[model samples]
Target: MMIHAMSASALSQMDQPAFVAALDGIFEHSPWVAGRAWPQRPFASREALLDSLVDTLRSAPRSDQLALIRAHPELAGKRAMHGALSAASIREQLGAGLLACMPEEFALIRDFNTAYKAKFGFPFVIAMSGLWRGDIIAAMARRLAHEPEVEFAEALAQIARIAALRLAERVAD
Candidate 1:
């Protein structure tokens, strides 16, 4: 495992591009999150560093926020099946047992993914840690019924959880 053994102070001292690179894969395909939060440096602790990153997400414009949400691949979607997921995403999904789905399980999640994207206009975003395929499918089914606004908020919240997990995995206090 590639663990980033830097403290908050070390990370705060890095240049913007370097900072972004260090945290590149933490926010799905959106390195801009770290790019934007670079100004809020001099973090007091690991928790504060994570807070600044997530705060960037919370305060972003609707379009940018939607872009971040859209940037995440669907759970057990085509990307996972094709072995094309990013390293962080692959690790998380593999831990969730998503990388080895059975044919029937794949078909089931494919249907859920199709319905989810059709309904929400973005892929379903979940922090797949400690979750099972059945749990994911149940979440997809339940989230499919959420109103657009509700589901949108839920997606952002889920993405926040993912970021926290990624940061914890890589960076130390």
Candidate 2:
């Protein structure tokens, strides 16, 4: 699982498969975002690469977009409880202190996840890189009140933010 330190210049020159391999995990379980955005390569900067990837997700079909959103696991939910999250998600959630939650905190988050999913038809999503679990819970509660369309857009934006953080970690500035 060694990640070679690939410069932006080096990454820009890669073939589609290579490019996707280097960046596929940045968007949780959605490697197709990078695969589809491969044609927009030769990025002049890391920001450009990020913009291309996010743009690809933004322009995807609704079904594909929903699938991408649904690809994310619930916070402190079954996946976290069972230790089944993807490596990227595990790191993000663990860093957010989700793995350290007390039983009461876990139950509160699980309840929020169930109610939120029931109402919105998707799990709550947020860029958890620097967030505390409490802050995440607060935000989730607030977003539960948003209209579906608004929440959908917000989820995509949060995914983009998560991707941006992941890109910064993996790619050179």
lDDT of 1 by residue, 1-173 (tens): 43877788899999999999999888989999999999999888889999999999999999999999998888888787788899989888898888788989888889999988898899999988888978988898899999999999999999999998889877886
Clashing pairs in 2: none
Q: Give RMSD to native, each candidate.
A: 1.1, 1.7
TM-score of candidate 2 relative to the true fold: 0.95
Off by over 4 Å in 1: none
RMSD of 1: 1.1
Cα lDDT of model 2 by residue, 1-173, tens digit: 23455677888898888998999788878889999988987898889989999999999999999999999999988888899998888888999999999999998999999999999888999999779999999998899999999999999999999998888878877
Lowest summed-lDDT stretch of 10 residues in model 2?
1-10
For every model shown, what is its TM-score relative to the native structure? 0.96, 0.95
